[model samples]
Target: MKQTQFKLICTLMAAVFTVSQAAAQTKEKQIFLSPPLIRSIYTADPSAHVFNGKIYIYPSHDIDTAVTDNGSGDHFAMRDYHILSLDHINGPVTDHGVALDIKNIPWAGRQLWAPDCAYKNGVYYLYFPVKDKQDVFRIGVATSKDPAGPFKAEPQPIEGSFSIDPAVYTDSDGQSYMYFGGIWGGQLQQWATGKYQPNGSKTDLQNDDAPALSCKVVRLSSDMKQFEGPVKDVIILDESGRPLLGKDHDRRFFEGPWMHKFKDKYYFTYSTGDTHYLAYATSDKPFGPFRYKGIFLKPVQGWTTHHSIVEFKGKWYLFYHDTEISGKTHLRNVKVTPLYHRSDGSIALIDPFKSK
Candidate 1:
């Protein structure tokens, strides 16, 4: 071929390659309705709160590791927490580096899982779950004056706290309650007898016909660092007032508890771990004998489902995470989308994979 012809062919090929690269980059940056709220690093288990008119997210910082999957969550070897903020819905998110690290926590052993943040009387409390030296999961608290923090963890875990997923919800009457617990990898089953049994079953009660395991809730003290009373069972009942059985995986509470109030009714939302559904129940009080409503979020492209619901600027939003970025269970990313409530006082279900 002539030299001029060859040069023209090479130029066309370069242009095609450039276009293809740009397209792939664009696709990589986005999933589920929009790009990840924080893309600089992998994050999951978003605990979002609106503080001082801005949305603050406390998420588990996922690090890539070669830990073999042990079904009890040995593969999710997270070690730190990062705080993310956004001025508005669908706006740019600001990642505020490392808010808390395991190295700085004296009582923490490993695997810093889901976390939540609470602000009271000009102080911000960050609640997280990590394994203690004995390999038992316990909840801990850290404090920071700012919503985004270099928080200082207390020298010890909260007394009588165990398992994973610590979500603190403050009710309208100025009372704060923490809803926490998880099965399987979270080790909720091991603590069923009110004591940590090393040989406890990794999953729920083997009898499917029996009442399923329930999460725990306790009123927070004025200091916001400790519990005010004995932990109570957060029972989720079906429409017929029957306790959901262990076999009811689709509606049973597994992990990731978040409470929000809409129009004077309390909404208790949580993840059905093995089923991967973001289900919710409602009650008239904060510590609820909540009635199971239905699932609001269908499963995404990941194994675990965790989320937070918050209202910002008169609109509600759901902040959740999935493995869309890395396509691996332990490495996930956080994303946000608007949430809506139907006029009949039910939450509209969200299917993340549905087309725009």
Candidate 2:
């Protein structure tokens, strides 16, 4: 065969190989688990929960990118809360209309990101991070008696550090714990929060009595607030250990810390590698001695993954955004999938070959 034919064959081979690998990764149990793939009703940060026999989704309203909402598409800055109900967790979705419009709340003009909902006592706490350039990115508390309602935002935000992405997890003991900030934190956490000192309890951050859970919970106190114990230093997301994100005393991986307690161990998931793909750490207690688990996911043919984990009702989902070819970083949509966990206890995202 001539050189040109050989080159053509080689080119064809490369394209085929690339396509095959891509198809296989997202197909088989290979790459990692990501979300919906086709985002019809969500954007940026996604907070999904099963409430009243349905999965209600709250997505980020902060349209930081250049894309225009145009009153349509994922670019729209969500001012009001849009509620969607799905009978099955892998949603065939229907928007139940705006459950909570900004006008329904006392504070009516802030952007929302990563809104979290938790049912406690007799009230539903719709915990969300508000986005305002002039305002400190903070978590807001909204409440309603009914799951679907004109949910009202509390006059006061979850006051502590400047924050965002409020993820509330009620422990097996009925302890309601909130995890967020960082990717939710915006610029505040970027340069400082990663430095670490062992023995610091998380409860040292605030004096609020909202529920008693520590804001940091770097070490779990019966109450989640800052620690009650004498820890070495205050809570910080340690990134000096992980080499993938970046290397500097300044660069750290403490963005989103969501944890789940297993038989005898606690699995803590946080974002570090580029504020994309998920990474995790495990500890005997909610506190330190956290062992690093390398990249739970990597950038795939689809979107960049963030704020992800296994959900209740036994299905797993990865929440993230994919940049459109039309525009790079601005337009993001949420995707979900049925996920599987590894026997070794590590999170294995589904590869293209196994996505089916």
Candidate 3:
């Protein structure tokens, strides 16, 4: 759809949902919308799974801030894991307990981010990011026998250079693949937990094999113990093909690329426009010639969304963090929408909650 037509449709849906929002204002009443799912789980970077008849939400717990109460000192930006489940994703959600935590793992006391889970054989592996004292960030894998479990976490980290926002994908070949790294060069050495040194504390610490690209992905060993190769680079925004996005635009892009295969074709979704909006690209191969799809979503009720997408109950939902309170924390909200594909090959997201 053209931008103008898309705006009109969104505006109409917004008006229809405005009444529902007002009704939801009373504390005794609950809205049919997506979040404040876990009020205590001050959220961001969400990962969802359908296991054992429930939709489990594993999100980055906002455990730290500059202030004493909000800030978890040692684990900077602690992504302490909390669980919330919903019998019917279309309605009321339930809160479970703290499934995993950083303080409990004293050896690597650091902040964790974007915990994602997948069930293989009989084990549920949770993938997330953490920063050690030197501020060097890496992804960690923990296994649980059950979705809601006594998770056994290992002290050893997933060996990779400056890896964070760990996402594991099990390909058709029975090969496990992980995609991570951020706008700021993926392999950059941490000076102190999520904080990077300008000079990159360790030379060649980022990746022994990657040339100069910031983001990388690689095949995982069958056991998911290590990478088969160096962190492979993906989504290098060097040009826009449009002259406006010259060399300058390449440097001014946000990086977070997540992919899923549909009908043998790879659909890669990424964060861009300063992470306020999501755009997509697709390719026949896992690697590129990835043509830009277009904007997936823009500001909602004047809110910016970031880092979220999932397929649950045979439907696709986009989960992102909105800057509801300006400079304050970005509270994570899950917006369940039906993703439609256009004949022209563009992806359109219809906000179901707001439409009716």
RMSD of each: 12.6, 12.4, 10.4
Query: Of 2 and 3, which scores higher on TM-score?
Result: 3
Quote the positional error of residue 80 for candidate 2 in Å.
3.1
- Across 74-164, the per-residue lDDT of candidate 2 in tens digits comes to 3334566665556776657666566666555554345555576777677777776655444445556777787765587767554453455
User: Ten residues in a row with the worst lDDT in model 3?
Assistant: 243-252
TM-score per candidate, chains pooled: 0.90, 0.65, 0.72
Report the C-alpha lDDT of model 3 over 1-356, residue by residue, as the tens digit: 24564455345434533442343233123223344454555665666667886777777766535542111123235646776678865667665677888875544546676667777778888776776656566677778888876566777777653556666667687777777664333333332234445444322222333322334567877666667886554543323532113123223224455667766767766654222456676667665545555567653422223454666767766665532322233344443444666666667853323333
Q: Across residues 210-270, which tens digit of lDDT does each residue of candidate 1 receive?
A: 8889999999999999999999899999989999988898899989999999999999999
What is candidate 2's CA lDDT for residue 153?
A: 71
lDDT of 3 at 313: 66
Off by over 4 Å in 1: 1-31
Order of models, best TM-score first: 1, 3, 2
Q: Which candidate achieves the best TM-score against the true structure?
A: 1
The local distance difference test score of each candidate is 0.85, 0.50, 0.55
Tell me how many residue pairs clash in candidate 3.
Answer: 9
